[model samples]
Target: MEPDNAERDPLPKTPDPLADWLEEPGSTAPGRSSWLPILAIVVCVALLSGAAYALVKLRKHPAPGSGLTAGQTALASPGSAWARDFPVSTKADLDGVCRGWYYPQSPAATGPAPHPITVTVLDNAFKMRLQPLSVHVPDGVKKQFRDAWQPADLAKVQIVACVDLVGSGKPLGKCSFTSPKVTTVPFVEGIYQITAYEVATGRKLTEARVIGAEECPLVALVPADDVLHSEVSDRQLYDKLHALVER
Candidate 1:
């Protein structure tokens, strides 16, 4: 047995091992170590946010001198509301009003004579009967339509069979002709695509349709007259016409 004086010397007052380890730069407390992962996450998130911002900025300014027209730009800028608001159709939408008329242009002193135009497109409702506008054509050539049809009747027809003028489906939206005499423009009528939009949302709503009879030439098949100013916008409709007369 040790003497009382030999009682175990007081244990040296050493620092806690855990506390010492924490004080070293190489070591960390459990709580503090957890903060490292959290901080790294925050940094990563900030970087991602910055990259997204840069991407958006790049879109706001397209490449300089891209040669994009205003219409093209309006279509290309999907980041803006205009793209959503003013969507254009790549196809001739059948959702709008359509009208068409055919007339003979009297052959000039030298040009090819126009005649015998074939009727291609007929309203799905009933094949519209084409009567010779001329009295010289025999009555036997007159074939009765299953249903009476008129320009006013186009609204009632649902589907319009459009055979492309070039035999290839292409937009024939504008028409102009020139001669030695004063230039005259005629309105070609058929299948005018009418696009309608929603007022509130600026969203395209439906394709409304307009059908009508175009003015015809007199019995002499006179030269086209100066189209009235009011009809100028409609001159663009010359493209939608399918020739019903083969000549």
Candidate 2:
């Protein structure tokens, strides 16, 4: 007979519910509730990560139509209507020249519009080779005014022009220009598709597809300095725009 004080086999060891649940495979019942907190934490972490990534991307690359930076002006015109369509195009009169279009059938200026007209150059090309030419463009354009309107008219007239690469991704050839030194290391190539607009009326004044070599590209309109003058094709573009306004 066993002694009364003798310890009997510990009452069949009591099963621990937590231990059993942990051991079970895919136990959804009561155990599922425990996973809720962990799942929520994971989901929150993923959402936060996504939000941060988006914020960084936006800061790095500002979206289109957001606004302009310093030294930049708006490109769009007030009224969206085009003044008139100058469909007639011209080719390079001389060999080794670029070709394009200018508005106004006549070389003369229509008259004079309000001073301080805005001109926007839209560069729709893969590469931005026309940037430098854009800087000197105002001088050339102003010269066109003088020629069309006259030297006295230049004082009264003002031209504010800016260049913008709209990222058209257009594949084009080279656009060469003759300089004083000529055959220099510093040179730019590629076909540049440029569109000039009169910002006030939103008129599509002139479009140029310059190829091969040119005399001062569009800068030729300015006769000052030792730089070469623009070819007939290039000059016509500016002249035509002035003609539109002179009207």
Candidate 3:
């Protein structure tokens, strides 16, 4: 009889909507949204992407003193070759062959067979002169010397003679010269041999000759050689000579 009261009214039981939704497979739950998980995934992906980009940027532009960007150092030439081995004899030797002088001991497999010749230039006194045989001089470069000599300081100057050789292993021929009024001369197109002479005596400043060769045909006005040896251009030969001189 007492138990019948239970069935009279289960004291106004409240329906739990969240519990009901959870029980249903497809129903949405309270305070639980699908967008939160989607947003979290998107945020994680963005963070990873940002980190990847940072690593790439750091690799491209590294800090200074980093050995990664450093270049190679130059070494001294072996003193076996004639040009590199022989000490410049005199000022006259420097003037005649120091500028636009080239000689290869072995024939280049790529360019034409070099036209070996002996080059010599005598001073006004004719007492001192440059004697460098087997030196190389481009065909059209002689004109550069002529044009350059037309100026006030170089007008009276004379190239005298030039020698060219095929392959010398190292640099070309050794040169010498004598000019009282000459400080620098455009021997071959863009190639210039600067001679710092004593202001009063008009002699060369440093006995250490400075030889510079340029292979820029368009800019230097030096022409390429089409000899019977190889296809090696004057530019290539010039570059080789430049490398040797710089060293």
Cα shift from native, residue 117, model 3 (Å): 39
lDDT of each: 0.30, 0.34, 0.30
TM-score of 3: 0.18
How many clashes does the backbone of model 2 have?
A: 10
TM-score of each: 0.21, 0.26, 0.18
Give the winner by lDDT: 1 or 2: 2
Tens-digit lDDT track of model 1 for 133-194: 22222233333221211122322222222321111122324334443444344434434333
TM-score of 1: 0.21
Q: After superposition, how far is residue 157 of candidate 3 from its true place, in Å?
A: 45
Off by more than 4 A, model 1: 1-31, 66-247
Residue 63 displacement (Å), model 2 = 22
- Candidate 2 on 112-204: residue-level lDDT in tens? 542322233333333222322222223545554444322232222222223333222232333344565333222233343445443222234
lDDT of 1 at 6: 55
Error of 2 at 181 (Å): 13
The window of 10 residues in a row where model 1 has the poorest summed lDDT is 101-110
Q: After best superposition, candidate 3 residue 98: deviation in angstroms? A: 44
